[model samples]
Target chain A: MAAHRKRTKGTVVVDTVGIVGLGLIGGSLARRLAQRGIRVVAWNHRPHPYAQAEADGIFCKSTLAELMTAEPDVLVLCNPLKAMPAILAELKPLLDEHPATTLTDVGSVKGMVRNQVKAAGLADKYVGAHPMAGNELSGWQAADPGLYDDALWAVTVDEPTDYRRFFAVASLITEGVGNRIIVLDDETHDKAAAMISHMPHVVSTALINELTANPDRNVAAALAAGCWRDMTRVALTDPDRTRAMVEEDALNVEVLLRRMASRLTDMADQLHAEQDQGSIVRGGSLKGDAAAHIRKFFAAGDPFRRYKAQTSSAGDFPARELEIPEAGWQQTLLFSARRGEAITSFIHPHQAVIQIRPAI
Target chain B: MAAHRKRTKGTVVVDTVGIVGLGLIGGSLARRLAQRGIRVVAWNHRPHPYAQAEADGIFCKSTLAELMTAEPDVLVLCNPLKAMPAILAELKPLLDEHPATTLTDVGSVKGMVRNQVKAAGLADKYVGAHPMAGNELSGWQAADPGLYDDALWAVTVDEPTDYRRFFAVASLITEGVGNRIIVLDDETHDKAAAMISHMPHVVSTALINELTANPDRNVAAALAAGCWRDMTRVALTDPDRTRAMVEEDALNVEVLLRRMASRLTDMADQLHAEQDQGSIVRGGSLKGDAAAHIRKFFAAGDPFRRYKAQTSSAGDFPARELEIPEAGWQQTLLFSARRGEAITSFIHPHQAVIQIRPAI
Candidate 1:
């Protein structure tokens, strides 16, 4: 690709950009950049994705060497965490030969990769970036060309970084792919990611695990609706990645897990206390402190209430009748009111039933 | 409105059905029904939805009485929980004067309302039904029209219920609303709803409440994405109805809550114990036991994983990097593996440094 490019002083104008690993991010970038008149030279480790990319008219190279031989002004790394080190190691010598060229990587975690590059002593020439966008589907076929539009591209620069080369890469990313650039130090980035991204994943995975592990899950699954579906949607995420995330960020995840555990324990203790105090009456009513606690729990901006209302309002169904077979016929009475009408006295459980002759 | 058409037995074929409460379910149902050449007579408690419904060609009824006087062969109940009891009571006497009429309601919990109807001696005329479809949105304008298509409509029939009327209502709902009917007894229906529908709501609500109530919620919220959003989508549910559902089905909801509480506690203990044991070694690798447990939790068919993948794939940027501090370097390492990538044993906590290197 260097053969097709002309270098003037320190500035390299890249006509064709080569992208390795044509997955969701890579494919999307290629499609978008190619549409913007920049030729995209792409390579996928998997032959299927490579064929698919070639068929989509995305410039495809058969091998890493072939990709490098294309001599593009820039090389984009869009591989997995495991493959990133190997790919970087392989490209280091080639990059050394072409001192005029620049390179960037799109990975979710930067600290480790940065260390890897630094260990390999390729820090000045390599920049680490992450585009904050994506979906569940993977592979080049699922890649849309317009994926990076208006997205934040975080570009991390170290103390030894070449300012000219950093700006050159950042400008291309912002102009060709991203909306803006967020320059952060490595430590702040990891902590923020742990709090915002990693911790949430652990929490979500834990919740899903809780639901599936329930002994009464059969019944729970039966009543599962959009709420359950939405809530546990991430539970089906790839187990390996999830496992790796939890393993890698065990400290922050442990903190989150502790908080969740404390809250759950408190809730459980309250429930048990209510049970011990005989607060749960047979007629689906909570009495005394139990009632107050239940009310407080519900009143605390719980989203379940809104979901119930939406689910309830979807169709015209009568309120469910609680069957008290043990308690036989009593004097039952029914008093009906109109919507928006004035309310009279509240009907007590006893008043619900009244002995009376038919209205004549 | 009654003057427009005579109340002949077969003359009142409902070409246009008016829906009063056009929330998520109502709106979706209306849209679907309207697509089938039926005119939707819609009336909301609020007047703001009228213009939007009219723009969508859903003929808005100015008043409830006007809708009642219009005498459509079928009247659907899409109002709120407390409102249903009153509306049904008022409409009971009016319907007694009009022959050849049928009515249905869509309420989440059925036992309480069924008891009210049975006490009022209106069971022979009214058929209670619940359609298992909904989202976090409300109001007539929020209606999607196609919501009920292919969903299951639970039809509750008891001793006092008229089979002929039940079948008629079921047929109309199945053909018109686009959902199949699942016949269930009132007791089974309530229990099933409690386990499946009500319990999920409580779990989701608890999660949201837990997240919101966190002292570090600002951090949690920033880190929140597809997993957190999907898990708490139900948190947008109507508060009042949620309060009632919890109160009325306190027994079942409590049971599920207890289960969730225990599960969460166990996970917390596991994570905490691992931390205490220093199971996360120098390389940031989780011990065999902890890793196995984490893997099992993730592989347990939770939907969160799937949702994460979808969210990660949908937007422009599939992969982005956040630099964590050296202190929190483990967080990035754990979550480094993206979806669709295999797990490899290359993470080195000691080698991991929080440095911003130049882009590749």
Candidate 2:
């Protein structure tokens, strides 16, 4: 252990960091760590980014063996998912040589990786992490010191794993990199990822394929409205990176796609049945409850969407100075439905904690 | 027609305009027409927006027959799809009684509407129109006089239909309402709408459905991250309006979904076979060309998306000031290497039309 090694977050200290596969996440971590006066020795497959990183004053190593010899306190694996196992195997020797050096991976998928590391009896030294961050852009050029800020990083661990080891790795990444730490089992993480990241990526990529699948590719492209741009933002990532992420969790995505297919089929059937009954037409269309089923189907998710918009819609929240004015003076009560269901009120001259529900 | 009627949009002219269905589109149109000093009479199924429109100083009529009695030069139907036909039927005797009145609809799906008008022998007085405009919100409060600005208003008509009549309607919308006119036939318009508007809506709704389908709705919502919000923006429309629009084109959306389903199935199969071969590991993963198929699938529409971004992305253009003074001293020079093509060189005191094809 180096004398410069100071506790960064809850029981986690690292003076020398070894960053492998220095692309966006690795490079970003390196940049932030170096800024915080921690030593980062790096290696990237491509020699150009390696040169750039070296020029930026990082100690660039040519090989993983050489990087391990730098006596790092921790190693961060930022390699593509498919390449992680081999990288981990290469790292096995270093772990044997330096038993104190711990490890973690930033791959999106974790179940198989956790299993592999667990089988290797290295679960004591490892925790699987995925920071839900990054723009559509990737690679070293896209790396930012603030990349992981305000993002949720899932710290996945199996049962019977070393909780202390998990906390050490998780705290370093979450507190050091400024991500909110969420503890989830590997399988739970994968299911959630399938819904949020992997499934959406599938839909986006499939959407592009569907539009271009027709000979009307150019015509369809002409009709690419506002919605298409935002929806396909995820599909614009580095091809190799996308493939690696999607490939690691293909089966789960397949199940998700099948489920989505069944839903679409059901909606289509409902629609066809209504149309066959000639209810999509004018005369008695309103009187008939044809659109009721479809509307109900859509309205189920309305609250969730509204809740997200009220809280998560981008932009600065409206700020202004409000006057409470002399405490004893009477003032009209004001409250938003969004603020709370009820408010604490004091009656006439008696200061009682009375909860008053808003009439609105 | 009132003698105060002036020629608008080169041919189309109106003094009094009846804006039926005073929702976002109708209210916005009324606002714009009133601003142009035209007499704007309005009718809505609801009383609130009608009162609001009247308060906003547009002549608010109570019934369709009352709106007809006002003897407007043109009638704009801004009702939802299912309601449009009934509204149009209500305007029928008026159409016959006042032979000079022209009618146009702003409903999304146009084929059935156009056919119905043609079958009713009102094609000469009618042209189907849909403005590719609107924010996420609907209704009078969301209406803006600038709603149709920069949006394409598709003017759809059938064969043996009045080309002059179509232009009269198209020009009124494009020039009067400030929408860019795109003259597409009813079928072409429907197909384009299916690809652009209808299918995307279905997919948005379906995506939210898929994510929230399980008991893990909250979990799915928490993991919603980034892509979920943008991808599901369109699914947040008024449920009834969404149902009407989607149901009108459900068969087409079903077809589109099936196409999407097939492509998704094919991609899943490819991923599965690649995984089953154990080639998803480091040894042969990249070497096995597993990701190549997936990458190719995503890359097909990248150019189209990129091209659209380059053109449609609204922002200030890269501007630079060039000093071209004392024009007689003109020069033409050449730069070479455009990859296996010819090159031409010319430098002169007087510049002529110089064309150069460079070679590499």
Candidate 3:
């Protein structure tokens, strides 16, 4: 495996993609890439998904050994978080045989795999990517070819990413498979994943359980408002998949839950203190800094929403047909040219907004 | 006020409606009722909403006293929660004189107003109503004429309600305005409101605040999914209005928040213990009752969502233009018959579902 790293190329674009674990993410990506006329071979331990993919025109490599025999240019380990290291070990023989094969994974957390790969001295051959796109639904049955459409794919790599091969393979999946890309390191990716998806997922499930467990379950259901529905939508997620995510990200999730509990405790205490002081308390009795803090806290989510609207809204500029005003190359350049992600112009039309996304 | 409750009437139907507040709920109801050829007069402290409603062809009353001078058949207290009792006190003298007027209100909580009115011995003169419909937006600018259409209007009354007058006024607002009706007592209504609206509102704001306060806000925002948007929509609410709702429902909200926090704590503990046990956990590590509880917890919300689809979804039975099959009378009877809130049939579709809701 160590010797394999030395046999590198200038720029490598994977012709064949070998994906292990044909769940929603893997199956969906396989379908998308295969639709784009790329050769995609997948290996799943279960015969059902493998047979299903084969029937769906996906090349079926019966096992990891068979996948290695095909000499795929890129190998994606899409197995559960706990299973990646073992899969990497199984693929090591293949890596030693074909040094040109770039290794990557589509896992929620990156630190685990990155650390394992680095420790195994296979760092140069590995890249980690996560597509920030999913629904509460799960498995091959729920897979959609356009799942990654306009989705954000974060590629986690070392500071000096392997521009020649490793990064190139990840970019093929990120860009060629049709997604916007952002680059960061493993720790940042894990922390961000914890905040954005993993922990929020737990909170959502807990919120659901709490409300549903209440004595007023029937009443709560009857008055289920839009916000409540949206907040708890993820609660309807497939139990098996949610279990995987929770178990894998348990530590990060616990940290997050504790953090949230701490915040809630402080809030409850503040309200209680206000009540005790006869301060004519409301729901939350903060007249100054605490109120400001809460406001600021809520305001923080706005940027992300705005950013999503800019990137993922219908007829996103890149996909739209703008009548190039005959003399409009100037205006087109004004909008199409990356003015450092001017999100406002896109949302507010008076600003001559250009619907543009910065390059990865 | 006590003498006002003794006014005898063979039958009562409010031909004219006087609404005391002209914000979203009040204005929307006023416009809807007025559109149905019913006379409506609205009075608000703010001249803007008042002027706007008047200009919109709604009869404008200068004040509650002026509204009483008009000799309206029914009066709706559409004022804020904190102000409803005082307004009731202000209108007491008028209530004593205008014995024929049936008084009702559209407030989230029923206990406060109902109790205060009962204390004044004006119980028979008052009925409490809350329409389970709203958006994050507030004020007259956001009001829609069809806001009540396809909504659930919960009408709260005493155990021995004045069916002739009370039901007539409530029926006018619910059935005539094209909404489904549910009847409950003041305490029951308050408890249910806490379970559904108030606490969920706080949780939404808190969830937004928690996720935003994370150091990974930019990333979290970038990865935010539809659930995140729906969950946090309430975060964009007007501060003053939210403050009012929270203050008004503080005690109930505290109870709900504590319950949610309790469930969250148990979850965190279980996950922590599971991680400690290293039982090869997945999303959540509960193998016995803990696991069953979670599954049941998530399952409880499904019935509500299904019930909402049955009652609130478009063309929801009543709102639909069902071409009555000459032979479809039986199914229609099975559906439209007052069989006591057969929520199961709409959800399961297999049940012979009596469309019955219990009469007060």
Candidate 4:
């Protein structure tokens, strides 16, 4: 194993990576890994992308058995989440035959995928990861290695998770794929994913729905500018895809939506009160309870604004090493993530080089 | 007046235009008009930009009295909305002296500006125009002539608005600036502005505020991608500026925010019910009241999605002439705008060449 491993500044823990489903995300990953001089073996549901993928220096396999013959250190399930149960069932026996290969997946919802893996009796070999990448485009035709450039991934682990398996997957992301990562439990990953992506997609959809229902929709559409365009961009994508993603993480999205709805309602009340007391207010300043509340609402996000400004102005964030404690190492990395530290690479199994980024 | 106007394909109704407050919108308009060979006279609160503007062939005036002395066909008040009352007060006596100079402003909210113009006894000379252009940038230094390229201007009018004044401003937008015009009444303009821009700005701010208040904020921020960035872009701008914009159209914004809140809440309920019935549902095909409601919500915006697709694919929208009726001309043009027609040029005061755009 040591003789087969290649050495960069840090040891390349994942010398060979196997990828399933050569769609946008998977295809892009395969090409990127191959570009990075890592041996990549890929299999798609259909062989259409195989010829083009092989042309990019990736080894194309016809079956799961053949892919397993290559002895990939990390096998990524990049198939659609709907295909999870069937694929997991098929991979169960093959993975059992080669127990040394650590399993991982690039599914957006972590807990559900973990559950599926558990149901397939492959929990011991699995580590969950979701790259914060992709665009409005899909399919092998739209795949590009640049899609993973400067991407951050959330690596999910749990209490019963094997440290060796976790190290293998984390090192693959940080060193093999040359991407940053933050450790999280399945719940934290799914909830955070819901907060940032799924909930926002639903909100965007609601906005377009509101516009479509308006009597003067054409007038509103004509007057739409940067704000309207940016806020509703995600809604303009394939609704069926968005609907599936939202439904997959339905519980987390539901909670965030209610919170967002409450926030909007509170703002509406403040605005209403301000209008009612319009006669008393002078200039642009309102002098009432509603005015104070509105001022507070606007000021609440100042920390985030300042953090973004700092990040934009300060190029190349400062880096430091995080020592992963032997006991409860998952909690240590999660706490580091909460402090806005992103693990760039593993110097060794117990040590990680993290970049300290501006926090909200 | 006819002899002073320059002739292209259509009569340039406003040849010599007076501009006050040369900020982003004002400076861009001044430059674009000057580029088109229109005589532009400008007065700023300060003369910092005057030299460069003069080099661009704009006649810089030292005072409102001097700007009025230019005897411009149209006077555009482009100062900040906060300075509007003071500027209107100063312009009132000067405008009375030269009653032929039609007054207009590039304000976001038409109703409020109209009221300010009415308060100064200049409503009879006023027409409300809001160019659907601008960026996150501000000031004269950030201004460029190309900002007006392929832009839309909402020309707002009321029952008592003089035909010639409205025509002068509309023609100035359509002919002088070479842009499109959609005629609307003050209420409709304010409501639609709130719907597409103002209300969405608040929702975006709320989103950032929510993330800021989250316990796993750093985690979510780390996982943030295109959707989070796009939805929160407006919120990252000067909150004070966004607040002012929202407050100016307080009533309209309040109503729309409440509507958005209700929509979000409805979606939340559907998602919750869908999750509750997850056990009974097979494969991603949900069955229940929740499933039906969810499907309906996702499908509601299909018209808008289809309209966007059509507009993006079709190059160069079809154009035709629309004749204006003497009685209820305001309603006639409003109806034309409702039908998704944008006035490109006025062949005459009573006739407009409108482009047929895709509608929801």
Candidate 5:
């Protein structure tokens, strides 16, 4: 809470921050902090990303040693998952030299990263954070300074975390990005993420892959229109990354998929049941029963009738006497007969009845 | 096909046309045809739809008998599935009285309706058609005159179809609405629609329903940007209609769903295999493996790396010669190394990298 603000403020005043991997998040943070007159430096594994970062006037230290020498109050690890461990190892010596400086990571998952950091004996200085924001698009070039505006930044800390260091890190993240911050323990964060982010991707990807593999895909694709495209757009994101996420979180994802599978199986079973019922009604074999069920099911309700009822009120019309025109020998007249009348009807071309009173 | 247009020019003519059911399709057709100097008189089973149609300057007749008295050269049926049979029954007597007139329907399915018409001995006068166009939105109010512009219109006919009647119906349908026409038999048309139109709705709705049902949906919904919203918009369409469409076309829909289930199962199996392999290789579950896999699946090849490779000459920058700065005592240092070569390494706060690289 803001009650610990005073202690963290002093720490932040002494802290200069270093960010590794100047991708979308790291790059955006660098830009925003520099604009706010905060001294921020970044290191990217790729020279071009850093080259572009330097060209964009975001502060970039020529060397990591020089950055460490600047004595940053905090360090933000923004590199990809595969590279983060090596970078962390490389920073161990510097961290031992500057025990006062804190470190945090902006990775999507926290439990694994937190465990690794704890195993490295940097638990007091290291915090794991995730800013729940991103587009399907990636990279520093795609980064916008305003990307984190109004976003939620989840900050995770454990019993080993120094309260002072945690508050200092949380303040910087909230201040730099102007995002609302929520604090959770590492395990809670991972489980929550699996439910929120990880599961949806698996479901979406599976659906897209299924549709793609369908023999009738060409026709379905043409009819895809709005809904189909919207639902599967995420599937078109990095398929490799999606596969990795689902596979890594296989246990949780498997549970979710099982749930989905059950729901689908239930649906299929219900359809089969309905098919049997329809077959009994129509006196047809089970082989053709599904088709009959479908026919009757689709024809059950009038779509227009449903829409009209949903959108309109019966009171919208004024009451009037119902009229039926006389019928000629060659003309077949169509009319709704009232309870008391069985009248002959006649049809006219120009003077057509635009309103008919339903037989009471 | 246009090569024979000269010979068929005067052979086909469409003037006054009767349209039953003034919903989106019927209303749009009336407006478009009116613009093209074709007389269109339409009728709705309900009073308000007719009232609204009349308010929109569409000619609405009170009764089927009145509409038939117009002796329209062609009649267009645009009612819903359940209402179609009864409407057709009422229109039959009128049709028999005027044998010179032709009839066509703009229903979503053809086989069942065509079968019913055949049973009623009205095959000679009816040509089934479906326009592949719609928004998730529905009704006469949502109708746009340009709804059918440049859309595909599938026209189905059989041995009973009059050649002259077919030409006349096709001409009217293609005149200002669809760009091309696909002529098919009744069974093919229904099967194609089941694959394309109905199946997509089922899949899209299922995805939306799954997302909506998630316990962590609050965060997911909050994090849902343009991509999530765009993907699920169609789920907001009439649920009952979507359910009916899928249930009615259960055979086709079941086939599609089964295909999806298999793909999901394969993905899960692959993920489990990878986990087993990783556990054996690394002695325990690899930390961040899932996140890494997800990211990798979605990762495009890094653009900056591609750019650097493309722009650099062989001798430009020796990989081993590159020096990366180590974080000094207090500063947070971030750096990148690719294939054992240091890219850019720097400390945060004092140095920042900023520039624009065109996305390749």
Candidate 6:
């Protein structure tokens, strides 16, 4: 294994970082980095947030070209996904001129962004990252550095991904932003994201839509309590944003949605069987096969339940060192993530201090 | 319209309430009533909470017979659904002797409880009620009077239900507990509850079941944020409790589950079609019929979104009085609830001050 120390203790490989957008994510990242005394240079599509951002110690640039003049060690594309192609096109020549600046993004979908980067011929310098942070609120006005507190990030990599480039983003999340890192391939990241977020958004939307269609919608709405409110909260957010996220990971979201539908249908069939069984299934108890199936359905998620309980009650999870092999470092880290281990810090370029988290 | 005065202004028909089962729901109701200067008598299957309940000014009884001695104006069965039959059987002779007491309950499912009450030959004294209150936590220790603060209750009545009995339970909610009331029949209450709470619980459980079955579950769990947390929160509660609730309201929950499954399946189909349409559905935007269907699906819940926005932003909702025709008063109040009106107070026996809420 080739062990190369990229930076000193308590510091990241990235010094000056260029942020391509000053939206919620980018603005938060810029503010966080500046608060941590790291040099942050950022440019937004509009100049609205520049004053406040500059006052927060971020060097706000008026143009992407101006942002590149800082010659940052890392450039994070935090602009809207719709602006990716145009921004990537503009940044390609500038990135070529400043060859040392590794390209990364805070996009929710990784594989799509990587493909776009490849199309722009900047794949050689690219790494994909998505921070598991944010709130119902958005835009520059809502951006706060605390949004990333104790956040975990999925740093996506591939066979062609440069180790140095991956390390730059990973170290930025780990040391600079003071967050945890879980290494995964782009497909794994997107599929897992769809399972957790994108697919659930569709399900939440379906719930409100169903309620809206019901003849007794007002009665149901009045009866709604914490369960209904919590379950459908995400559906009330901007549908256009959710639609965009789902479509970006359309294939994965579609697959997961079908799987969810199947799960619901199976439960419905079991319940219907219990209903048809009549007196044999008396007093809130099911009969025969339906009983067993219903029990199994509820019991299936026990592992996740236990995991949540453990993590919520846990404080300062114990950490251990994992040696990264250069020949297959990416797989090694991905395997570690599968075991519910998050990289808290890199002791050196080849050794990561991983913390064990409760897993399903 | 027949007008009869039941109580003077600022006074409820119930001066004392007898609560069976001093658990979460019962304990909270007892505490709230006691705090409001109303006499509260309670009995539990266990005597563990007797001391603390008595300390809170509640008259704790060791047996159901002793509880009936209070001669409460309203007798509320706050025990679990499974215990309903046994509790009702024990109280049958007692309730017969204390015929002046109006019977009600805090069960989540109204029809089932009403059926049990009817089977126990106590239908003449029973008025079904389900409070839109509670949290994930349970038991007497977790119970607090604040749980009833600004809560709305569904008071169920049948064609044969006595108006005075319904008024006793209704006034207990409005005046004694300082909560709002919505009158409904057993079927409407059960159906509306299934739509909002029970069906959503199953969907939430199905979500966790799907996640737990996935190979990349830990990856997805690691990437999970607020959406996953909120959507699956109810599933993390006692599975047996959820199973019991679904089974008790089997027919309604079963119907809603199937509808939800169909909605998810439809969305999945549209997403698949968009995928098949190739470059025509470029950059997070759909094309053709699939596009139109997807747009419609997302837009279908707009009314609910608007209603939520309006309600959350508005304060001190304007209220107006509605005359209650005694001949068909039950139907009149049910219609009021369907129109999103909650009874804040009964100005007279035949009139209700209903507060208008945003309707879906």
| Model 1 agreement with the true structure over B39-62: per-residue lDDT tens digits | 677777777877776777677787
lDDT (0 to 1) per candidate: 0.57, 0.64, 0.63, 0.90, 0.58, 0.89
- What is the CAPRI rating of model 6's predicted complex? medium
Q: How large is the interface RMSD of candidate 4? A: 1.4
Q: Which pairs clash (backbone N, Cα, C closer than 3 Å) in model 2?
A: B340-B360
Candidate with better lDDT, 4 vs 5: 4
Give lDDT: candidate 2, residue A211: 65
Q: Number of clashing residue pairs in every model?
A: 106, 1, 12, 0, 63, 0
Residue lDDT tens for model 3, B1-360: 223122212222567888888888888888888887678888887768766777677888777888888888888887776665567778888889998888888877787777767766778788778887777657788888877766776667665556555555644654346566555667666776776666666666666666656665555555566656666666556545664565456567666677677666666676676667665443234565545544454455554445444554435242222222333333442233222242211111121222332211
Question: On residues B60-119, what C-alpha lDDT tens digit does candidate 5 reach at each position?
Answer: 788989888888888988887666667777878889999878888887767767876776
lDDT of 3: 0.63
Interface RMSD to the true structure, each candidate? 12.0, 6.7, 5.8, 1.4, 13.1, 1.6
Which candidate number maximizes TM-score? 4
- Quote the positional error of residue A356 for candidate 2 in Å: 25
The DockQ figures for the candidates are 0.13, 0.20, 0.22, 0.75, 0.10, 0.73
lDDT minimum window of 10 residues, candidate 4 chain A: A1-10
**Model 2 docking tier (incorrect/acceptable/medium/high):** incorrect
> For model 6, how does the per-residue alpha-carbon lDDT over A205-252 read when each residue is reduced to its tens digit?
999999999999999999999999999999999998888888789899
Superior by DockQ: candidate 2 or candidate 3: 3
TM-score of each: 0.60, 0.77, 0.76, 0.97, 0.71, 0.96
Candidate 5: C-alpha RMSD to true structure equals 22.9
Per-residue lDDT of A1-360 in model 3, one digit per residue for the tens?
A: 223122222222567888888888888988888887778889887868776787677888777998887888888887776666677777777788888888888887787778777766678788787887777666888878889886766666674445445445544653347555445667666776666666666667766666556665555555556666777666665645665666566677677777767666655555555445554423234565544444454355454445444655546444222332333333342233223221211111112222345221
- Evaluate model 5: give its lDDT: 0.58
Error at B165, model 4, angstroms: 1.3
| Candidate 1 CAPRI-style tier | incorrect
